[model samples]
Every structure is written in C-alpha cells, then in structure tokens.
Target: MTILKAMVLYKQEPIENNPLIYSDIDKPEPGHGEVLLRIRCCGVCRTDLHIAEGDLRPIKLPIIPGHQVVATVEEVGEGVQEVRKGDRVGVPWLYWSCGRCKYCRRGLENLCDNALFTGYSVDGGYAEYMVAKADFVHPIPGFFDDRHAAPLLCGGAIGYRALRLTGLLERGEGSLGLFGFGSSAHMIIQVAINKGLDVYVFTRGEQRQEHALQLGAKWAGKPTDESPIKLDAAIVFAPAGWVFIEALKKLDKGGRVVLAGIYMSPVEKLEYSLLWLEREVKSVANVTREDVREFLKEAAQAGVRTEITIYDLKDANKALQDLKHGKLKGSAVLKII
Candidate 1:
C-alpha cells in the first residue's frame, strides 16, 4: 500500500471554502490495459470549479479532480500495446468510451452513454501518480513542455471542437465571434486567426479584452456590445447562459452559436426571433480521441501558445479559486513535477 500525495475532494463545496484537501492516498497501480503515470503538470479548468461548487452533479465523491494532465508513463500493464514506459502523454476529459456502444460504433464516442470521464468519474492527475487507460491517453507533441501541454488537453481540444461545430471551416472564410476571453477562447482565437477568419471577442474584463486584441482579434468588447459587423459564427465559452443569448443577437442570419462549457447556468428563455431565419445553436460535448489528436496537430502547426499562470500542487484550491473569480490572466497550471 504505497502512499502518494493528492488533492482530494471528500465533498462538494464552494471553491472559496477550499474544498480540496491535500492528503496521502494509496498510489494506484496499472491494471490490465492501463498505464501508471508520474504527473508533471495539470491545468486548472472551469469544469473543475463547477465540480467544486456543485454546479455539475458529481458522479463520484472523494475524487481527485484534474483532467488536463501531462505526465510521463512510469509503467505499462498487461496487454498494453503502442504505449510504452517513458512516453510523455496527456490525459483528457474523455477518459474512456465503450467501443461497443452504438454511439462509439458510429464514431461518436464523445457521446457514448457508457463513457468514463477523467477527474469526474474516476481519479485524475491532481496528484503525484495516477493510472489511466493506455489506449485513451495521447502522446504529447515534442514541442510543448509539460506545463504548456496541460491546457491543450482540455481547453485547446474542446475549444477546437466548438470551432468546428460552428461550420466555419466548411464555409472557407468568415467573421468569427468569441464570447469569452478565457483559457479556451484565447487558444481558439489563435487557430481562427491562422485560418484568416476575422475574430471579434466579447468579454467583460478590460485586461481580457486587451489580451484578445493582442492575440489578433479585429474587435474586442463586452458581450453586450454590438459587433462592428455581423458574425458568420460565434462560440460562447462562458458558463453564464446569458452570454449564449448575447452571441445569438450579434449573429448573421444562418449563423451558428456553439456553447463550449461543460456545465452552464440555465439559459434565459430565447425569443423566437433569435432562432428564426436559420440561426442555430449548438453545444460542445466531451472531446473524442480524434478531436484531441486533430486539435494537437492543428495547435502545433498554428504555433498556438498558451498564456499560463503557474501554481504548486498543494495550492490546487487557490488555482481553482482564481479561476472561479476570473483572477487568472490565462490558463492556471499546477507545477507538480
């Protein structure tokens, strides 16, 4: 019964209350088809905040909450192929999806009913060690260091999925609106800029707006502010449902709004006019393995760089607290290694 230090949540509470307790727990071993990883870094996410505050119902209690994990494979279990010890890998939100499910068979594993989520359903990387399904983890790109790669596993991958859902790529070129300037949206804007899309950003914070401008946004203002031009597509990264409605108001006819949050507040009742004229709304679900792979490649090619604020492993609560209050300028990463 080897012990390892972890920030564990015994119960859900407000992030301000410091719900995560740092303690020594039994270090997990690599089960069959799984691998043991020595965590290097983990990115703090809004989803982690939601789980802390009980916005999203917990699937498992006493969980170690961190999904954006960058680690080195320390050992491989029986029947594990392709992944070897000493490989640097990343574990994302979608931990495992039953391949035999109908949704998985149809290549919609992100929507698999029998899916297990890292950090949510099982223990995740807010620790010195953890075990993950070998087939589910992805090899981190050589160019990105551990801290930088952490955010890409979740924010970059999911944000990329939201961008694709907007149908902007198929349309070739168009104006794109991002309704937040946080971790995910910032990364998405870089990719959108690379595609030659005119990016407009809507966020409340002055610094965030400036950050958006610095990242090549054509326009940056509050969510309530009117866009200079009608947008062909918009992605709302804020958890507040009102931001979703605001994006719709600025959309051109037949444009789409893709909501990127894993858990969002109840949306305000939408007027029929917002949905009229083929204006569409869609939500980004969990990321599939394909989404992760594709996003990593695209991010690497686009030279997507993350603005990160570093934290220590024992200070997971503080990291998430800053995240909840919007104190973080960019992604918050725990430097565990």
Candidate 2:
C-alpha cells in the first residue's frame, strides 16, 4: 500500500479551531471511468474557507479540502481514455452528476439535485494523489504553469460564468461594477478590461483598490463611495449580502446585479426604489462544463494573467487565515508537489 500526505478536515469548525490537520493516509486509486492524478498545485478558494469555518454545511466528514487541482495524470482506470499517462490536467468543484436528472438532461448539470461537489461531498486535492472522474478532469492549456492554471478551475471559471450571467456576452461592452476585489474579482476585472468594458471596482481595502487600479480598472474605491458613472451591470463576489445592496444602488436603469457566491450572509432590507426602472437581480449557480470550456478558451485568447500568492501545502490553514483577513494579495495557491 502506498502512503500519501494529505490535509484532512475531520470536522466542520472555525479555522481557529484547526479543523484541517496534515496526516499520512493511503493513496487513492482510480475507479472505473476515473483517473489518478499526482497533484502539483491547488488554489485556495473562499468556498473552502466557508466549509472550514462552518459557513457551508459539510456533506462528508474527514474529507480532503481542496478542488482547484492542477495535476498530472499518473494512471488511468478501466475504460478511461480521455487522458493518457503524464498528461497535465485539472480537477474543479463539479465532481459528478446524474445524467438522468431533468436538470442534467436540460444541460443545467450545475443545478442537478444529484450533483456531487469536490471538497464538500467527496475527497479533494489537498494531497499528493487524487482520483477524479475522467470526464470531469480538464486538460490544462500549455500557456499557464501549475500555479496560475490551478485557480482557473474554480475561481476564474466561476467568475467567467458569473460575468456571463451579467449580460456582458450579449451586450459586448458596458460600464461594470465588481464588488469585492478578491480572487474571483481579480480575474474578472482582467477579462472585462480585455473585452474593452469600463470597469469600476469597490473594495474597502485600500490595497485591493490599488491592485484593481493597476489591473486597468477605470475607477476603484470603497463600497461606501459612489461610482462616478452608473454601471450597466454589477457582480457581487463577497460573502456579505450587503455588497448586493450597495451594488444595487449604483446600477443604471435596466442594469443587472449578479450575486456570485455559493453562500452569503443575510441581506439587509432591499428598498423597492433601488430596483425600480426595470433593474434586475440574479444569483449564479454552479458552473456547467460548457462555461468552463468557454472561459478557458476566451481567457487563453485574451492572454489573461492571474496574480497569486504561493503557499506550501502544509500551510493551507495559514493561507485560509490570510484570505479571511485579506493579508494575501491576489489569489492563494498551494504548491504540493
């Protein structure tokens, strides 16, 4: 039996409680239609923090807690041919879904009731080895190295999908507001700038505001401050629902606000006047495979670059702390291999 090092979350508790502990465990093997991967890197996401801090309920206990996996396909299981040995690949949050479900049949697998999520429902990639459904693992483009591509699997991909829901795909260009200049917002601002959209960023941290300006944002300021111009669309990536309310007040008539988190704190009261004049609000759900592919393609073509702070796999808890306190700039990624 092969032994591997992994950071296992034994309980759903606060990060201060040290929920995740590093341990030596049996290496996993690929099952039928699955493939084994030697993990090189995994991006730390807010969702991981949510689970670790008990904001999101855990579906499985004693599970590894990471999903933005950048790895090498080390082995293939029975009937798996999508990837060959030594191929570089990525594993994202969407683990598996029953194709027979009506949501799946309608190409809305993200909303399927039978969907299983990596790091939440099953074991994930905060380890030396990981097993992934062959079809769910994506082929990483050669342009990005392990650290950069790791985040695109989740943060970047979700930001891409969420941005699409804001009507940018149909309208082409507009004034955009990104509330919370965190990991997802960093990638989104770059893509929006690449598309020639005027982007205004709102973050309470002066450092994040400056970082957004360096990324070519038309303007950057605190959420309490106002945009010089009304936005055609807004996307809220923060866990606080108050960002939605604040962003709602900045939209142009007929503008839209897309809330992009899997979980959020309760929103304060929404005034009818803020949503008058045909404005709309919608929340983004889990991403479809199509969204991932499309995002990867467009991101590559646009030469999108991700700013990240690297941490060793052993320091995942510390990394989570930095994210919670906004100590780390850009995105956080764990270098395991």
Candidate 3:
C-alpha cells in the first residue's frame, strides 16, 4: 500500500491546540468512473471553520476538512472522459448526487436527498492526493492559477447562484445591495458591477466598508444607516438576522432579498409590514451542477478577482482560527504539495 501525508481532524475542538493531527495514511485509489488528483490549492471557507469548531455536526470523526479544491489529474479509472492525466480540475462542495432521484431528473441535483459532500461526507482535498468522481469535477479556466481558481470553486460559484436568485441578472440598470463584504459577497459585487448595476454595500467595521468601495461598490455604509437610494434587489451574506430586516427596509417595491449564508442567528419578532410591501425573501440552498457550469463560464469572461492569504497545509488549523476570528481580509487558502 502506498502511504501519503494528510491532516486529519480526529476530534472536534478549537483549532488553537491543533485539533487536526497530521499522519501518514494509505493513499486512496480511483474506483470506477473516478480520478485521483494531486491537490495544488484548497480555499479555506467559513464552513470549514464551522466543522472545526463542532458547530456543524454530522461529519464522521477523523475526517479531512477542505472543499474548495483545485488540482491536477494524476490517474483515471475506467470510463472517465471528462478529465485525463495532467488535466487541471476543480472540486466543489457538492461531491455526488443520486442520478435517479426526482430532483436530479429535473436538473435540480443540489436538492437531491442522497447527496454527498466532498469534505464532510468523504476524505477531501487536504492531502497531497484525493479521489473524486470524474463527471463532477470542473475544468479550471486557463487564465487562472491554482490559488486563484481555488476560491472560485466555492465562493465565486455560490455567490453567482445567490446573485442569479435575486433576479438582478436580467435587469440592466438598478441599485444592487450586498449586505456583507466577505469573500463571497466581494465576488458578487464584482459580477454586479460588470453587469452595469450600481452596487451598494452594508457591512460592519470601517475597514470592510472601505474595502467594499475599493472593489467598485458605488456606496458603502453600515446596516444601521439608510441607503442613499432604495435598492432594486439585495443579497444578505451576513450571518445576522437583524441585517436581513435592515436589508428589506432598503429595497424598492417588488424587490427580492436572497439569504446566501447557511447559518444565521435567530431572528427576533418583526412586524409583518416588512414582508407586506411586495418584498420577497428567498434562501439560497446548495447549488446545482448547472449553476457551477454557468458561473465558471461567466467568471472566465468577467475577470472576477479574489483577494487571498495563503498558508501551508500544516497550518490549516491556524487558518481556520483566523477565519473564525475574522483576522483575514479576504479568503484564506491552504497550499498542498
């Protein structure tokens, strides 16, 4: 058996004391319709932080934690055509879905009941080698480097899905509001600006607001204050429910609000008038394969930029800690040999 070095999370705890242990494990093999990838870079997302801190339970112990992966194909199994040896590919959070399910038949694979996640359900890209289903991997654009493409796998793709859910793609001119200025929201602002929409950003901290303006947001302010102009549509990326209420109040009539984050604090009771004014509130769930393909095509053309801080694979725990405490400005990435 061939051995490979990998960072394994054995128990849920704070990442400070190195909750993730480095060890030598047997390298995985490519089964039928699978490919073994040599991981280059993997983006550290907020969901990884949640898994490290034990907030999102359900993952089996002694697992590798990483999802947004960019890698090169090292080997391929039988019946693999989408990728071959030396091909650069991207592995996203959604790993596999049962094809015969009702949701999968309708092209809504993200909603498939038998879905498996990359890092959560199986060993993922935190190691030098990992195996993924060939059909699910996406081809990285030629213009992007490994580090640049890693963030796009999750943040850029999911942000694009949230933006599309808002109905802002068809509207040529309107005020678009982003309720947070993190990795995902930053990408969304760029896509919105590229489409000729005026972008407004609401986030805490003066530094975040300034960063938002630097990224082409026409106006940047705290959620406590009112916007200069009412927004035609808004996407809330903050994990605070109060921010959701604030965004609804800033929307124009018939405006839609897309809740992009997976977890949020409990919302306090609010008056029904907030939703009574034809203001729609919709949640963005897991993304479909179509969402991934469309976003990659647009990202290749729109030239979306990612602000990232790179760390060694051994320091994944540190990266998660910094992300949990909001120490980094943009996205964090872990580089594997």
Candidate 4:
C-alpha cells in the first residue's frame, strides 16, 4: 500500500485556524467497479465552504473536501469498461445513484433517493489520489486543461442543469437573465449567446458586473437596478434572498426563474403579484450524469471560458478562505499532484 499526502478536515471550523491538516494517508485502491485516479486539480465550490463552516453538517469526519476533480486513471477495477488506465477524467458532485430507484428508472437519477455525493458523503479529490465509480467519471474535453476543467465539473454542469430546469433549451429567442456573475454565470452567459438569446446580469458588485459585460452580456447592473427588457428566463446563483425577488420582478409573462444554489437566505416576504403573471420559480438540485455529458459537449462547442485562481493542494484551506471572502474573481482551484 502506498501512502499519499493530503489535506484532511477532521472538524468544521474557519479555514484560518488550521481547520484542515496536511497529513499522510494510505492511497485508496480501486474497488469492484471503481478506478483509482491520480488527481491533478480540484475546484473549491461554495458547498465546500458551507461544509467547512458547519453550515452543512459533515456526513463523515476527517473527510477530504473536493468534488470538481480532474485526474488520470491510474488503475481500473474489474467490470469497468468506460475508462482505462491513463485516461483523463473528471469527477463531479454526483458520485453514484441506485439504479433501482423510480427516479433512476425514469432517467432522472439526479433525484435518486439513494444518491451518493462525492466530498459530501465520501472521500473526495483533495488528495494526490482518489477512486471513483468508472461509470460516474466523465471524460475531459481536449480543449480544456486540468485546472480549467476542474470548475466545469460542478459549477458549469450544475449551472447548465439549472438552465435546463428553466425549459429554456426548447424555447427560442427568449431573453435570459443571470442573477449572479460567478464562474457558473460566466459559462451560462456564453451558452445563452450561442443560443441567440439576449443576456442580462444582476449583481451587487462592480467587478462582477464588469465580468458579465466582458462575457458579452447585453446588459449588466446591480440587483437594485432594473433591466430595460423583461426576461423569459432567469437563473439565480447568489444565495441572497433579495436577488430572487429582483429576478422575479424582471421576468416576463410565463417566464421562469431557476434557483441554482444549494442554500440561500430565506425568502421572508414575496408579493404574489410578482408571480401572478404566469411566471414560475424553480429550484435546481443535484445534477444527473446526462446533464454532465450534454453540458460538456455544449460548453466545448460554445467555447465556454473559465476564470480560475490556482492554489497548491496543501493550500486547500487558503482556497476556501479566498472563496468564502469572495476574494477570487471566479473559481478557486487546488492543484494536487
């Protein structure tokens, strides 16, 4: 058995106080249908921040916190056919789903009752090596490098899923509004442009607005500011409650607004008139593997771009701190081995 160095979080605490310790652990071996991967990069998501701060309780202690992983297969277990040794792959938040569930039977595995989440429910990619079910690993597109593709596994894929939840993919010539200009919104903006839809962004900070504009958003303004045109669909990535109301107010008749974050401030008060015009609000949960496949293909073709700040694997805590404080412009990634 080989020993590998990894950053392990034994307890939930602020990142600044050495919440995660760098230690040696036995490298995980491929299981019955799993593949051992030599992790190269892992993206730090807001969910990770939540877990670290105890906002989301840890499913297991001494866990390695990461899911948006890019790695190369080092070994393959029996019964694995989709991936081979030395193949580059990406691991997402959805680790596995019970195929016997009604949701899985209906090809809606994202809602599976027995779904397992990487990093959340199992050991994840915050190490030199990790293992995953071969069928769950997605092939990285040739156009993206490991660091660049890391964020796409979760932020990009889930954002794409949120967009799909809006039913915008089937609709034509509809205005799309993104209620936050984070990494996900950046990718979504490009996709909207490729689909020939106008893009509007609502965010509080000036920097995010500039980023939205740079990504070809037709209009960008603070949440308090109003858009000149109503939106056919909107996606809210910000966890702030007020943004949701602002986005709802900007929706056209029969429009939809998808809430993309895992947790958000409570919607204390909302006027029914805002939703009385046949407008609807939907929430996006964990993504299906099919969503991963489709989003990666479309992202590759749309020339989706990611803005990332890189940190060494041992600096995973720093990455989380930066993400928590909103110091990074886009996504924060930790380069392992």
Candidate 5:
C-alpha cells in the first residue's frame, strides 16, 4: 500500500493551536469519471482558516483542507475523456454539483443544494496527490505558473463572481470599492481597473494599502476612511461584518454590496437609511465552473498577476495563522511538490 503525506484535520480548533495533523495516508486512486492529480501547489484561503478554526462547521472530519489547487493529471478513471495524463488543471471550491438539481438546471450550480465542495465536503489538495471530478477541473492557462495559478482557482474566480454580482460589469464604468486588500481584492482590483472602473481599496494595514495602489487602485485607505467618491458598487472580502457596513457607507444610491467570504462575523443591526435607496446586499455562495473558466480567461487577458507568499506543505498551519493575523501581504501557497 503506497502512502502519501497529507495535512489532515482531526478536529477544529483555533489556528493558533495548529489543528492540522501531519500524517502519511493511503494514496487515493481515481474513481470513475475522476482524475488523479499530482498536486504541485495549493493556495491557502481564508475559508481554510474558517474551517480550521470552527467558524464554518466541519462537514467531513479528518479532511485535507485546500481548494485552490494546481496540479498535473497523473491518471484518469473510467469515462474520463476531456483530459489525459500530464495535463495541467486547477480544482476550485465547487468540486461537483448535481446536474439534475433545480439550481443546476437554472445554470446556478454554485447554489446547488447537493454540491460537494473541495476541501470542505471532500478531501482537497493539501497533499501529494488528490482525485477530482474530471468535469469540474479547469485547464490552467499557460499565462500562469503553478504557484501563481493556485490563487486564481478560488481567490480570483470567487472575486470575479462577487464583482459580477455587484453589477459593475453591466455599467462598464464606475467607482468600484473593495473592502479588503487580501488575496482576492489584490487580483480583482487589477481586473476592475482594466475594465475602466475607478478602484478604491479599504484595508487596515498601510502595507496592504500600498500594495493596492501598486496594483492600480485609484485610492487606498482604511475601512473607516471616506473614499474620494461614492462607489457605484463594492465587494467586501474581509470576514468581519463591520467592513461590510463600511463598504455600504461608501456606496452610491443604487450600489450593491457583495459579501465574498464563506463565513463572516455577525452583522450589526442595519439602519434603515443605509439601505433605503435602491441599494442591495448579497452574499457570494460559491463559484461555478463557468465562473472559473470566464475568470481565468478574463484575468489572463487583463494580465492579472497574483503576488504570493510560498510555504512548504508542512508549514500549512503557520500559513493559516499568518492569514488569520493579517501577516501575509498577498496570497499564501503551499508547495507540495
């Protein structure tokens, strides 16, 4: 029985306590319609943090947690035809959705009730190898290398979904506000700017603010600081609910606020006036296969680049701790190969 080294979560606990246990598990084989990947790297996400710390209840215990995966196909199972061995692919958060569900029929597979999410509902790519649904994996464009491509699978795809939900794409031109300047925002700001939107970034750290400016954001300031102009739309990537409100405060009358986090702190009571106009608040549930495909193409065209901090696969716990404490300047990637 061949074994593979993986970071497994036996239980949820504070990331400070380092809950992921390093272990040698039996190597997984590709099932029917699945493809086995030799994982090159996995991007550490805030969702991983939430799952690790118990903010998002565990669906599968002793699971390997990482969704933003960049890998090469090492083998394919029965009925898998779209990809062959050595093909580079990316596995995102939305692993597989029941095509017969109402939401799936409506082309809203991101909201499918019977969906199995990578890393949360199933073992993900924080290891040497993983098996993923062949139909769900996206071909990693040659525009990005393994490390840089990992963040795009989730951080970029979900951010693109949140941006689309904000209705900025419909307008073609407007002031766009980003409430957090972490992994997603940094990449999204580049796309927004390329689309001719005036990008305003609100984050806590001076270093993050400068990073936003460097990424072509028109304005960068703390969440509490007033933007130079009212935003036509905003996306809150921070897990704090207060930042959601802050983005709302900077929005124009008909603007929408899209919450991008999988888990966030409880929002305070809303003042009626803050939402009195045609304003709307929506939460991004997850990403669809279309979202991943479109985002990858658009991001490549826009020359979107992810600034990453690399960590050895064994140092995943430290990566999550840094993410929780705002210690990372950009995305964090676990190098598995």
Candidate 6:
C-alpha cells in the first residue's frame, strides 16, 4: 500500500484549535467506476471551515476535508470510461448522486437525498491522493491551471448556479446586488459585469468593499447602506440570514435573491415590505455537473481573474484558520504534490 499525507478531521472543533491532523495514511485505491488522482491543488472553502468549526457537523469522523479539487488522473478502475490516465480533472462538491431518485430524474441531482458529498460524507482532497467517481469528475479546461481552477470547482460553479437561479440572465438591463464579497461573489461579479449587468456589492469591511470596487462593482457599501438604484436580482453569498432581508430591500419588483450557503445565521424577522411585489427568495444547496461544465466554459472564455492566497498542503490548518477569521482577501488554496 502506498502511504500518502492527508489532513484528517477526527473531531469537529474550532479551526484555531487544530481539529485536523496531518498524518501519513494508506493511499486510497480507485474502486469500480472510480478514478485515482494525484491532487495538485485544493481550494479552501468556507464550507471546509464550517466542517472544522462544527457549524456543519460531520456525518463521519476521520474524514479528509477538501472538496474543491484539481488533479491529474493516475489510475482508473473498472467501468471508468469518462477519463483516462494522465487526464487532468476536477472533483467538485457533488461527489455522486443516485440516478434513480426523482430529483435526479428531473435534472436536479443536487437535491437528491442519497447524494454523497465530497469532504463531508467521504474522504476529500486534503490528501495528496484522492479517489473520485469517474462519472462525477469533470475535465478541467486547458486555460485554467490547477491552483486557479480549484476555486471554480466549488465557489465559482456554485456561485454561478446561484446567479442562474436568481434569473439575472432573464433581464438584459438592470442592476444586480451581491451580498458579501467573498470568493464566490468576487468571481460572480466579473461574470455579471461581463454579461452587461451593473453589479452593486453590499458587504462590511473596507478591504472587501475596495476589492469589490476593483472588480467593477458600480457601487460598494455596507449591508445597512441603502442602494441608490433598485436591483433586478441579488445573490447572498454571506451566511448571515439578515443579508437575505437586506438583499430583498434592494431588489426591484419581480426580483429574486438566492442564498448560496449551506448554513447561515437565523433571520430574526421578515418584514412584509421586503418580500412583497413578486420578489423571491431561494437557497442553493449544491452544484450540478451541468453547472460545473457551463461555468468553467464561460469563466474560461471571459478570462475571469481571482485573488489567490497559496499555502503548502501541510499548512492546511493555517488556511482554515485564516478563512474562519476573515483574514483571506480572495480565495485560499492548498498546493499539494
């Protein structure tokens, strides 16, 4: 058996407390319909911090915790025909879903109850070697490098899904509000602007607000600040429920807001005014394979740029700590073998 280094979470605790253990473990082999990969990079998402901090409880213990994966295939198991050896691929949040469910039948596999999630339910890419379902693995576009493409596997794809769910493409001319200027919002803003929509960003902290402005946001302000112009749509990437109400206040009539996080702070109260006038509210649980393919193509073609903070794979704990404390400016990524 090959020994590989991985950051395994044996318990859920605060990120600063060092919940993940970096140790040498037996490298996993590709099972039937699976592909073994030599991980190049893994993007550290807020969701990873959530798993570490107990915001999202782990379904299993001693699990590797990284979902935004970019790697090159080293081996393929039986029935794996989608990708061959030496192929560069990405493993996203949607690990694998049962194809028999109604949600899967409706092309909404993200909602499948039997869905297996990477890093949460199964071992993920915090390790140098990872095994992913061949069917679920997506081919990385040639333009995007391993480190740069890592965030797109989760933040970029899911954020693009949220933007699509908000129906921003439905209206050609209108303002779009982005609540929170984190990894996802930063990428989505460029796509929205490229699509000809005026992007307004609502976020706290001058650094993030300035980053938003640098990304071509027409306006950037705190969540409490009122928008000068009503927005046709909004996407709440922040985990604060109050951001939902705040986005609604800025949306025009018949507008929509999509909450993109798996967890969020409670909504204290819902005023009638914020939800009336055919305005809508929705949540994005996860990303579909279609979303991954579409976003990668579009992102590659549009030349989307991201601010990246790189860390060695051994420093996974530091990356998670930085994410938990809001120290990261753009996206945090682990550079592995």
Please name the candidate that would achieve the greatest TM-score relative to the true structure.
4
Better of 5 and 6 by TM-score: 6
lDDT of 6 at 81: 84
**TM-score of each candidate structure, all chains considered together:** 0.93, 0.93, 0.96, 0.96, 0.93, 0.95
lDDT of 6 by residue, 91-171 (tens): 999999998899999999999989999999999999999999999999888988888889988999999999889776767
lDDT of 6: 0.89
lDDT (10s digit) by residue, model 3, range 1-337: 9898888888888777788787798889999999999999899988887787788894678888788999999999999987889999889989998999999999889889899888888888888889999989998888788997788888888888898888888877788899988888887787788888899999998988998998899989999888999989999999899999999989899899999999888889777887777989898878877778778777777788888999999888888889878798678999995
Whichever of 1 and 6 has more lDDT, that candidate is: 1
Model 4's TM-score against the true structure: 0.96
Q: Which stretches of candidate 6 lie over 4 Å from their true place?
A: 170-172
* Global CA lDDT computed for model 3: 0.87
The candidate, 4 or 6, that scores higher on lDDT is 6
Predicted structure 2: lDDT = 0.88
TM match of model 6 to true structure: 0.95
Model 2 C-alpha lDDT per residue in residues 233-317, reported as the tens digit of each score: 9999887878889999999999999999887799879899999999999888888877777777777776778889999899999
Candidate with more favorable, higher lDDT: 2 or 3: 2
Question: lDDT per model, in order?
Answer: 0.92, 0.88, 0.87, 0.89, 0.92, 0.89
Query: What are the per-residue Cα lDDT tens digits for candidate 5 across 1-337?
Result: 7888999999999998989988999989999999999999999998899899998989999899999999999999999999999999999999999999999999999999999999999999999999999999999889999999999999899999999998888788998899987778888988888888899889998988998888888889999997899988999999898888888888899889999988789988778788978999999989999999989988988999898999999999999999989788678999998
lDDT (tens digit, per residue) of candidate 4 on 1-337: 8889888889999777868889899988888999999999999998888877788878888898899999999999999987989999999999999999999999889999999899888889888998899999999889888898988999999999998888878875778989988889888888878877788999888978888888898889987797879889999999888899999999999999999998789987999999997999899998999999888888888889888999998888888888877698679999886
Error of 1 at 177 (Å): 0.8
- The number of clashing residue pairs in each candidate reads 0, 0, 0, 0, 0, 0
